[model samples]
Target chain A: MGDHLARAEDFENKAEKKLSGWGLFGSKFEDAADLFDKSANSYKLAKSWDKAGSTYIKLANCNLKLESKHEAAQAYVDAAHCYKKTNINESVSCLDNAVNIFCEIGRLSMAARYLKEIAELYESEQNIEQAVVYYEKSADFYENEEVNTSANQCKQKVAQFSAQLEQYQRSIEIYEDIARQSLSNNLLKYGVKGHLLNAGICQLCKDDVIAITNALERYQDLDPTFSGTREYRLLADIAAAIDEEDVGKFTEVIKEFDSMTPLDSWKTTLLLRVKEKLKAKELEEDDLT
Target chain B: MAASDPNKLMAKADKQTRLSLTRWSADWKSATVLYEQAANGFRVAKDYENAKIAYEKASKGQEMLSSPWDAAKHMESAAALAKDLRHWQEVVDFYRRASELYMECGRPQPASDALAKGARALEDSMSEEAIQLYTDACTILEDDGREQMAFDLYRAATNVYIKLEKYTDAASFMLRLGLAADKCNATNSQCKAYLNAIVIYLYAHDFIQAEKCYNDCSQIDAFLRSDQNRCASKLLAAYRDGDVEEIKRIAQSSVISHLDHVIVKLARKLPTGDVSALKAEDEEEALDENDLT
Candidate 1:
C-alpha cells in the first residue's frame, strides 16, 4: 500500500505540471493517466478500497483532461464502487458526480442506468428517502428513453417504499396510473385487478367511506374486466363489511380472499388497518350499550 | 318534426354534427355551439353515449377557441353522462379536464372547486384520488397565497391519517398544522393542533414525542387556560402511573372528549391490560426477542 501511494504521488505531481508541445512542457497526461490507473489497480490488489478509490478519482480527472467523457464517467463509477465498500455517503457523492457528467454529455440512458445502481445502493442501506429520489429520477430517465419495462420496475420500487413511508396516496396513484396504461394497451390487463385491490387497501385506510365505494365503480371503469375478478369481489366484500361495521364479517371476507389466494404479510398488514376501523366502531357500539 | 321522435332526433343530430365539424374547420366558436346543440339533442333522445361524445367534442372545440370556461362546462356535462353510466374513471378524467381548462384560464378558484367535486365523488372508493385532488387544489391555492385554505386542507389530510390508525403520522401532520396556525395568529387553532399532536403521540406509545408536544402546547395561551388542557395534564399523570381507569376518567371528562372524538377512540386501544410497569415490560420483551434472534 505504501509503495503504491508513493508511486501514485509521483504520477500525480508529474500530471499536474504544465505541458508545452513536443514533450508537452515536460508533462503528458496520457502517461499520467496510465500511471494513475496502475496505482489504482495495485491498490485494488492490496484490498485497500480507500486508496483504490482516490487513485481512480485521479485517473478520472486525467481521462477528463484527455476529453474522453465516457472514460471519465466510467472511472468515476469505478471509484464509486470502491468507496461503497467502507463509506456509503462517499460512494453516493462519487456516483452523483459520475451521473452529472453522464447527464451533461447527453448520455441519458447511461445516466439512468447508474441512477438505478445508486437507488439500489440506497435501498440496501435503508436510506429510503434517498432511494425514492434516485428511483424516481431513474424511472423518469428510463421513461424518456422509451425503456418502459425498466421505468415501470423503478416505479414499483418508488410505490413500495412510498407505501412503507405511509405515503399511501402516492403509492396508490402510481399503481393506478400504471395499471390504467396497461389496460389501455391490453398488455397485462389482467394485472390491473391486483393494482385496484392495492388501491382499495390504501383507500380503506383513508377513513373516507365515500372514496372506498366510489373507487369500486371507478375500478370497474379503469379496467372493465377487473369487475369479474376474484380480487375485485374481495375488495367489494371488504367494503361491504366496513359498511355493516361487522368485524367478524370483515375477518371472514379476508379469510375467504386468502382461500382464493393466500394473503402475504404486506396484504395482511393492510387488512389489519381496515380491521382497526371496525374495532373502533365496535367499541363505540359497546359503549352505547 | 315530432318532438318525441327519438330515432329522427338522433339522425338529425348526427347529420348536423358531421356537417358542422366538416364545414366549419376554421370557426371553432360555431363548432362548439353546434356540438353543444348536438349533445343536447342526443340527451333528449336518450342516447347517452352519443350525448357524452358530443359534449366532449364541444369541450374540445371550445378549448381550441380559447373559451376555457365554456370548455369546462362542456367537459362537466360529459362527466355527468359518464357518471350516470357508472363509467367512474371517465367521470374522474372529465373532471380533471375541466380543472385543467380552468387552470388554462388562470382561474385557480374554479380549478380548485372542480377538483373538490372530483374529490367528493372519489372520496368513498378511491381515497388516493380524492387525496390527490384535494392536494392539487390546495397546492394551487397555496401558491396563490391562500395559506388558510392550505392549512385547512392539510388538517383534513391529517384527519384521514388519524382514521387510518396512523397516529405518529397524524401527530406529525398536526404539528405542521400547529406551526402554520401560529404563523397566522390563529391562537385557538394553534393550541388545538398542538394538543391534538400530544394526544396522538401518546396514543402511539412514543413518550418522548408526546412530551415534546406537551411542551409546545403549554406555551400556547389557549392551552394554558383551557379546562381540557388541565385535564390533559391529569391524563399524562395517569399515563405515567399506567392507571387505565384514571386515564379513562380524564379522557372521558366532558371538556376533553369534545376537542377530538378520534383521540378517545385511539386511547381505548392504548391499554395493554398489564399497566403495572410500562417501559420495563416492553424492554424485557425486546431482550427476549433479541435472545431468540
Candidate 2:
C-alpha cells in the first residue's frame, strides 16, 4: 500500500511537471489529466480511498483547466466513488460537484442520476431526511425533463419513506396525486386502485373528515366497479365505526376483513390505533349515557 | 409392549396438528378479507349500516394483529360511512376514537386533527354538542402548544354560540378568547374578542356586564377607545337615564352597532325598566358561575 501511494505521489509530481511544460494547451492539460488519472488508479488499487479521491479531484481540476466540463464531471463522479469508501461527507461533496458541473453543461439527466445515487447512498446510511431531499431533487429534475416514469418512481420512493417516518398526511397526498394521474391515463388506469387505497389508508392518520368524505365520494364515482371492491368497503366500514364510536362493531368488521385476507403489518398497526380510540370513545360514551 | 410404534403415531399426530394450525390461520385471514370485501359491496349498495359493521369487523382483524394505525383507519372508514348516513353522533364518536388512537401512537398533532374533524362533524347537528366538541378540541390544541389552532377553535365555537342566539354563552367564550389572545400578544384578535364580548353582553340585556366588558375592552384596545368611545358613552348615558327609546336609537346608530338585529329589536320592544329579560340572563350567568365553582 505504501509503495503504491509513493507511486501515486510520483505520478502526481509528473502530472504537475507536464502542466508546466511547453506544449499545446489541450495536449499539456490532457497529459496532466492522464497522469493524475493513473495516480488515482494506483491509489485505488492500493485501497487508499482518501488518496484515490484526492487524485481524482486533481484529475478533475486538470480537465476543468482544459475547459472539458463533461470530462471534469466524470472525474468528479469517479472521485465521489473513491470518497464513498473513506468519508461520506467528502463523497457527498464530490457528488455535488459532479451535479453542479453536469447541470452547468446542460446534462440534466446526468445531474438527476447523480442526485438519485446520492439519495440511495443516504438511504443506505439511514439518513432519511437527506435521502428525502435528494430524491425530491432527483424527481424534480426528471419531471422537468418529461421523464414521467422516472419522476414518479422517485416520488413513490419519497412517499414510501415519508410514510415510514410517520409523515402520513404528506404520504397520503402524494399517493392520491399519483392515483389521480393514473386514473386519468388509460395505460395507468389499472394501477389507480392501489394508489387510491394507499391514500385512503393514510387518510386514517388524518382528522380531516371533509377530506376523507371527499376522497370517498371521489373514489365511489371514479368507477362504479371500484365502489363494489373490497378496499372501498373496508374504508367505508371503518368510517362507520369511527362515527358510531362502536369498538365492538369496529372489532367485528376488522375480524371479518382478516378472515378474508391477511393484512400487512403497517396496515395492521394503523388499524389497531383506530380500534384503541374507538374503545376509548365507547368508554366515554358509556359514561355520558 | 402394548405401546409399540408410539413414535410413529406421535409423529403423525404432530403433522396433523401443524397442518390444521396453518389451515386455521389461512381461514382466519380469508374470512377477514371476505368481511372487508363484503363491507365494500354493502357500501356500493348504499347499505350504510352493513358497511359500517363490515368495517368494524375489518378493524378487529387489525386489532388482533395489534396494528394501531391500521385499526384506526378502519374507524375512519366507519366514520365516513356514518357521515354518508348523516349520523353526526356516530361521526363525532369515530373521530374522537381516531384522535385517541393517533395520540396513543405518539402523534399529538394528528390527534388534535382528529378532534378537529370530530368538532366539524358535530357542527351542523346539535349546537351544544358541537360547542363541547370544539372546546375539547381547543383544549387539546392549547395543551399541545398549538396556540393558533386553539384560538381558531374558540373563535369558531363563539361564532356557533352567536348563531344559536346564545348571546351570554358567546360573551363568555369571547372573553375567554380575549384572554388567550392577550397571552399570545395577538392585539388585533384580543381587541376583537373583547369588542365582540361587549356586543354579545349588551344583546343579552345584561347592562352591568355590558358596561364592564365595554370598559375592559376599551382599556386593552386603543382603537376602540379612539374610534368608538363616544358610542359607548352615549349608550351608557341612555342606559343610566332609563330612556328606553334613546337607548334603542343610540344603539342602532352606533359605529359598533351591526350587532344581531333580532336581539336589538327584541330589546326595544320590552317595557321601560322592566329588565325581566336581563334578570333571566343574570340567572343563566349565575348558573354558569355556580357550575364553575
Candidate 3:
C-alpha cells in the first residue's frame, strides 16, 4: 500500500517542487506569497518571528502586485513590528516601505504616523526636517490616532514642528536679508539710476504711471545729474501712443537737451526747428482765437 | 765721251741693272713702278690687253703684301677688268671678296656700301637673292640687339608687307615695334601701337574688338584721357546705333564716374525736355541723321 501511495503522490510532489522553483525565479509575487504563506503558519507555530516577518513581507509584496493597498500596508506594518524586536533599523526601514505604500493608497494619515515614527527614529539619529515633518503629521493625525488625550509623542511632535517652522522661517528671512544686502552693494558699485530708468520704462509699458514716476524719482535721487532725454523721449512716445497732445513732453525733451552745459549743435538746431514749428502752431492758434 | 752721254749711259746701265736686280729680287716697290711704267707704255701704245695685264700685276703685287685696303683696291680693279672681260662670275667674286675684307676691317658702313653695290648688281638677275642678302645683314644686326637697326629692318619689312598687301603681317610687325617700345618702357609708343591696333580692328569693322583695344589702351596711364574720350564717344555713338555689341563692350570697360554722372543727369533732364537741346546737337551730326530721320 505505501508503494502504491508513493506512486499516486509522485506527480503531486513533483508539482510542489516545480511550484517552489517557479516562486524563486518567476518574479511573480502572488505565486511566491501563496507558497510562503502555506509554509508561514508552520513557521509561526514554530515561534519563528523572522520567518513570519519574511512571509509577511512577501505577502505585502503580493498584495502590492494585486494592488490591494490597505492589505499591503497592514502587512508591512506587521512586518515592521516583527522586525522591531530584532533590529530597530530594519523595523524602521520596513515601516518606511509601509508608509510609502500607504501614501500610494491615499492613506495619508497612516503615512503621517509612519512618517512621524521614521522622523522620531531619524531625529534620535539627528535628522531635523525629517523629525519636523513627522511631527507636523502627528498633529494632522491627532484626531485619527483616537486617543483620549494627545500622546506625549504627539505633543513632542508638535513642539518640534513649531521649532522647525520657526527655524525655516528664520532661514528664509536670512536669505532675504542677504539678498537685500547684495542688492545694496550692487547699487553702490554700479549706480541703480540706469536700473531705475529701465524699471520706469517697464512700468510705462505696463501703464503703471505711478510706478513709472516712482522709479523715475528714485533714478533722479540716485543720479542727480542724470540727463532725462531718453526718459523724456519715452514719455513723449507714450503720450503719442495714448493720442495725447504732448507738447509738454516735447518741452521736457527740449529742456533735457538745454540742461547740458555744452549743448550739441545738432540738437540745438533740431530744438530750434521744433520751437519754430511750435511758434507757428501758436501763431495759427492765436489767429484762430 | 761727253759728260751728258756718259751720265746718261751710266743712268741707263744703272736702270738696266736695277731692273734686272728688281726682277731677281722680286721687290714689290720696283715691281709696282715697273708695272705702272708698263701700264703707261701700254696705254701710250693703246695695247689695252697688256694695260690690263700690267694693272693685274700691280694688283697681284699689292695683294702679295697682304694689305687689306690694297687688296680691296686690287680686287676692285680685277672686278673692273673682269667686267670689261665680261667675266660676270669673276666680277661677283672680286666684289664679294672686297666686301668681306671691308667687313673684316670693321668698316661696317663701307662694307654695307659695297654690299649694296653688289646687291644692285645682282638685283635684276636675282632680286630674291638681293633680298636674302639684306635679310642676312639685318639678322646680324638683330642678333647684336641693335634695336634701332632692327627697327629700320622692321620698317623695311613692313613696307614690303604693305607692298604685298599683307596688312596683317604689316600689323604684326607694327606690334613688334610696339613690343620693343614697351620693353624700353615707352608708354606713348605702346599707346600708339594700341591705337593702331584699334584702327586695324575698326577698319575690319570689328567694332567690339576695336572698342576692347580702345579700352585696353585707355587703361594705360599715358593714353588715359584720349582713350577715355575715344571710348566714351564710341559708347555714345554705339548707344545711338543700338549696337548691342558696342554696348556690351562699353559695359565691360571701366566705369568713369563723371561720365556716369553725366548720363544720369541726361536721364534726369530727358523728362523735362532739357535733353532735347543735346539731342538736337546730336542730330546735327551727319552720323546721327539716320536716328533723326
Candidate 4:
C-alpha cells in the first residue's frame, strides 16, 4: 500500500508539471490527462479511495480542456465508482456530471445508463422518492433512444416505488402502458401478463373492485394470451373475492397462486396493503349494521 | 457388572431390573445402581437412544427411593438426549418432568430454567405450547420472589403473540410485563412496557383499549413521570381529536422514534383513516350531549 501511494504521488506530480509546462500546440493537456489517469489507477491500487476519486476528477478536467467530451465523461464515471464506497454525495454528483456530459456529447444511451445508476444508488440509500425521479428521467431517455427493454426496466422501478408511496393511479398507468407496449414485440409478449397483473394489483390497492374488474377485462382484450396466464387468473379471482368481501377466498386464491409461482416481495407488500384495506372495509360494514 | 461395553452394561441392567420386578422382595437399590451405571456407560459411548431410556428408568427408581434431586438430574439427562435426537415434543415433556421434579425439591430457579429451556426448544414447532411453558416459568419465578427474572419471559411471550398477529393478546402480556417491571422497581422497563402496550393497541385499531391502557398506566407514579407517558398521552389525544397530522407527528417524534423497533413500527402505523376515529368521536359527542341535557 505504501509503495502504491508513493508511485501515485509521483504520477500526480508529473501530471501537474505537464499541465503547467509550455507545449507545442496545446499537446500538454493530453499528456497531463494520461498521467492523471495513471495517478488515479495507482491511488486505486493503494485503496486510497478519496485520493483516487480526486485524481480521476483531475483527469476529467484535463480531458475537458483537450475538448474530449467522451473521455471526460468516462473519467467522471471512474471517479464516481471510486467515491461510491466512501462518499455517497460525491459519487452522486460525479455521476450527475457524467450524465450531463454524456447528454451534451449526444451519447443518449450512456446518459440513460448513468441516470439509472443514480436511481439505483438512491434506492440503496432508501431514498425512494429521489430514486423514482431519476428512474423516470432514465426511462424517458431510454424511450427516446428506442431502447424499450431498458426503458421498461426503469419504468417498473418507478411504478413499484409509486405504488409504495400510495400513488396507485400513477403505478397502474405505467404498468398498463408497459403491458400495452410489450404486447406487440414477440420477445416481450410473454411478460405482458405479468405487467398486467401488477397493474391490476395496483388497482386493487385503490380498493375499487369495479375499476379492477374493468381493467382486467381491458387487459384480457389487449393480449389474447393474457387471460390464459396464471397472473390473469389470480387477478380475476382476487377481484371477485374482494368484491364479495370474502377474505378467506382472497387468501386462498393468493395461496393457490403462490403454490405454483411464488410472488415477489413487491407483490406481497401490495397484496398485504389490499388485505388491510379489506379488513378496514369489513370493520366499517360491521359498525354500520 | 464388569462389562465395559455399553451394550453389555445395558443388557445387564435390563436383566437385573426384570429379576427385581419378578421377585416378591424387590432389590430396588441394586437395580438403581445398575441403571445409573448403564446410563453413564451408554452416554460415554454416544448411544443416546439407550442412554435416554436408562436415564428415565434411573429417574423413576430415584423417585421411588425419595431422592428427587437425583431424579431431576436423570430427567435432565433424558431431556438432553431428546434434544440431541431432535425430538422436540419429547424434549419438552422430559424437561417439564424435570422441572416438576426440581420444584418438588424446592429449587424454583432451576425449575424455572428447565421450563424456559423447554419453551425455547418448542418455540418454532409449537409456539402456543411454548407460550404456555414460558408463562408457567414466569409464574414460578414470580412466586419465588424474582420479579425481575420474569421480565424477559413476559417479553418473549409478548413477542410471540405479536408474531402471531394476536395484537390484543400481545398488549395484555405487555401490561402484565409492565406490572412485573413495576414490582421489581425497574422504572425504565415499566414505562417501556406500558408505552409498547399503548402503541400495539393503537396499531391494532383498538383506540378504546389504547385509551384504557393509557389511563391505567398514568396511575403509576414511575410511568407518570416518564417520557413514555407523555408520548402516550399525546398519541391518545391525537387519536381522540381525529388529528391525522398530529398522530403522524407524534409517531415521528424523538420520544417515540427512540423506543424499540417494533414499538416504533407500531407507532408509525397509528391509523390515519378517519372511519374508526370519527365513529369514536361521534359517540363521545353523543355522550356529551346527553350529559348537557
The best candidate by lDDT is 4
Mark the regions of model 1 whose C-alpha exceeds 4 Å error after superposition: A1-27, B1-293
lDDT of each: 0.74, 0.72, 0.50, 0.85
Q: For model 3, what is the error of residue B162's alpha carbon versus the real structure, in angstroms, after optimal superposition? A: 5.6
lDDT: worst 10-residue window of model 3 chain A:
A180-189
TM-score of chain A of 2: 0.82
Candidate 4's residue-wise lDDT over A41-84, tens digit each? Answer: 99999999999999999999989888898999999999999999
Per-residue lDDT of model 3, residues A1-289, tens digit only = 4443343234334434644565543455555556555554444555556755776777777777666778888888877777765666777788888877664443546776776676677677666666666665554454333221333345444443433333323332322233222232312323333333333333443443454455455544434323333544444454343233245665665565347634445334434444455556567777998
Instruction: List ranges where model 3 is wrong by over 4 Å.
Output: A1-289, B1-63, B73-95, B120-125, B143-146, B149-154, B157-293
TM-score of each: 0.46, 0.45, 0.25, 0.49
Better of 1 and 3 by lDDT: 1
Candidate 4, B1-293: lDDT as tens digits: 35556567567656665644466654567777778877766764567798899889889889988999999988987887787778888888998999999999999998998888788667778889888999999999989999888776787777678778899998998999898898878998889899999989888888778889999889989999989998899888778777788888888777775555446656766673563556587788889988954
Candidate 3 Cα deviation (angstroms), residue A9: 99
In every candidate, how many clashes are there?
17, 66, 0, 0
Clashing pairs in 3: none
DockQ computed for model 2 against the true two-chain complex using alpha carbons = 0.01
TM-score of 3: 0.25
Q: State the DockQ of every prediction.
A: 0.01, 0.01, 0.00, 0.01
Q: Which candidate, 1 or 2, has the higher TM-score?
A: 1
